[model samples]
Target: MNPPTSTWWTWLAVAALGTFHGINPAMGWLFAVALGLYRHSRRVVLLSLIPIALGHALAAGSMLIAGLSLGLVIDHSWLNRICGTLLLSWAAWHALRGHRMRPRVGMQTGFVGLAIWSFAMAASHGAGLMLIPALMPICSALPGAGGAAGAAGPTALIAAIALCVHSAAMLLTTGVISLAVFDRFGVSGLRTKWLNFDLLWTGTLAACGLVQLAL
Candidate 1:
């Protein structure tokens, strides 16, 4: 067995995708921060990232499984349009109702609730879907990636490493940003600002989806 080749370009691609995903306002990191704020503990904030990372892993893993098992087929244009349209509809509904989806933080539920919420959010947004496809080629090129020989060791190792790196980057970036916002503005201030911007962000996502759909 040979050591799997590591490529800088692959790492960079993963980082880029993670960064891009981290900036999305609807991602669970924002809610993680809210969780931390609700508890008035930085410790809770840091701990909250665990569930977020797990959620990301779950999403990415699911995509990989689909691709490997059934050959995941995605029409990027169609998916984008569908996603965008859904976002837009959700936004419009919220706007009309003068309501925004807010993270629920309660003592009884605590960390468990946070984890479940993060998982659902990440899954719904297709957070890890893009990364898996982007990394698949590189992952498949590894020596053990093909056939039974590769399955037990090097190929699986490389895939796991890649997934870990990508997930870590996303979680770190999001966690830092969310924590910074909480520190600077405090919970109430952060909530107000996010709510105010939610409509705009939601609209933008919707428009992007629509454009993709149209294409």
Candidate 2:
């Protein structure tokens, strides 16, 4: 079934956010290219996409689950306040101390390790919380959308759709960017430019936090 016309923008926004996230090097492509370069193979870089996508999906999915749960227990105003508080707090932590809580993978990282790292990075950055406002409406539209006890059907469905759309967009971008970087400028180029990305990530995280508060 087609989603409501009004909600079309929301889904588009979801996809857009996915694309936006993918563009950020911290999300996956940068690391994947580095790994490939370390091993001297393009195939490894391509293989890296699977775990990257999986970890990102899990991280984003957790937030949707949280949103669904929050709807059942609290009113929207409270939810807004909580989300805002959390986002701002995370931003503050990152600003003052940096992501010390971020997971560290060994030089010889496995798929599971990479996935864990991705989840930690995504969660600490409040990637999922950024989508909460966009999801809350659809999650709360139907009767018991929060599912008094079980997962609300509509909430689950929409969250799944959002996750899929976001993941696909992210994966596509990550693959393309990874390939381009590996083929053209080379992995060293990614390392040279990474410092700038660090600054951008911090600013973006803080900006998103402020946006959550505004919402």
Candidate 3:
């Protein structure tokens, strides 16, 4: 059966944001490509994605948990305001200093190091915070989401499903981009055909904040 229009849109937004994050080089694909090139092995590129996705999932899951916990205490309207303000603030910071803030990991780094870098990158980029808007409705649908009562199980189950869907989308997109770059264009492709995703991401953060506030 088809989902309701609202639910459909929410899922779509989740997937769309994941895709957007995937496109951003800081999210992992570019690093994966670099590692593969440095090691002179396509297999290395494929292997890197696993830890990258795992790290991203960890960051995103933590944010969902935090948002849910806050929802239990804060009024919906105030939560919106707070999240919106955070989004805007993050946007401003990302625009002005995000490039300089990237964690430096050497080419010889191990899987665990790569995973840690991925987690830090995702967190710094506010990748998880972006999901709060989509998450609100799902949590809100529960009767006692504003309380700690019966809402915990259902909210957790739904949040996990949502996080899985989002992470899968991000991993798929990141893998495709990583493989394409590794096999065909190589790192030189970045210099020749780089898209300024930082600017786009900053605008998106601002838009998310405005939308949340407007909601």
Candidate 4:
């Protein structure tokens, strides 16, 4: 089925989120670069993107399931309010003490390990949770597209598209950055940045939450 003309903004949000996640080193790109350098092969870095995206997808899909479930049962207005509140709460928690929430990273994890790590890290960081409001707007817009066996088609399609777009963006960025770091200046290049990624992430979280609340 074709996407509604009115849904362009929704699609843009999905893609934008992907690009945003791609830019985040914690999303796995930095690790991929490290893995590449450790093995002295770019192939390793490229392959690492697979499980990284998979784990990210699984993490995001979990929230998609939750959003879909809620969309099917609750009124859009109420659902929005709930999501708004949740986002705000998460933002505050993250901003106040995001460091303490980081999942323990494994030092010896391989491909599968990387996938699991990505999933755990993304989930713990509320990456999926951040997408709820964006998805809810589109998913809830569909009338009768919830709860019923036949009702999920449109929402499912959108969610699937979002997953693909996000994964692709993350993979592309990971590949590019990993390669650049591998060939150019290595990890030291990343250190040139003065801004703290965590603080930036915290601010982003808060901004997204505020937008959700305003919506």
lDDT of each: 0.59, 0.76, 0.87, 0.76
lDDT of 3 by residue, 1-215 (tens): 22234577788888988898888898999999999999999999999999999999999889877877787777888998998999999999999998889899999999999999999999988888899988787677776777866677776776787788899999999999999999988888678788888899899989999988987
TM-score of every model versus the real structure:
0.64, 0.86, 0.94, 0.91
Predicted structure with the largest TM-score when compared to the true one:
3
Please, what are the lDDT tens digits per residue for candidate 4 over residues 76-151?
Answer: 6776677777767776787777778666555457888899989987886778777776777667567575564555
lDDT of 1 by residue, 76-181 (tens): 3344444445545654654664233445555445666766766666655545445544455554565544454445355455556767777778887888887887
Name the regions of candidate 1 deviating beyond 4 angstroms: 1-7, 69-108, 143-154, 187-215
Candidate 4 weakest lDDT stretch, 10 residues:
142-151
How does candidate 3 fare on TM-score?
A: 0.94
Candidate 2 residues lying further than 4 Å off, grouped into runs, are: 143-151, 191-195
> Which ten residues in a row are the worst by lDDT in model 3?
1-10
Please tell me which model should have the higher lDDT, number 1 or number 3. 3
lDDT of 2 by residue, 1-215 (tens): 43445667778778877887888888888889889888888999999989988898899889867866777767766777777777677667777666466566765898888888888777766778777767666665655544455435556677788889888988999999999998898866655676665566667656665665665
- 2 or 3: which has the higher TM-score? 3
Q: Which is superior by lDDT, 3 or 4?
A: 3
Q: What is candidate 1's CA lDDT for residue 213?
A: 45
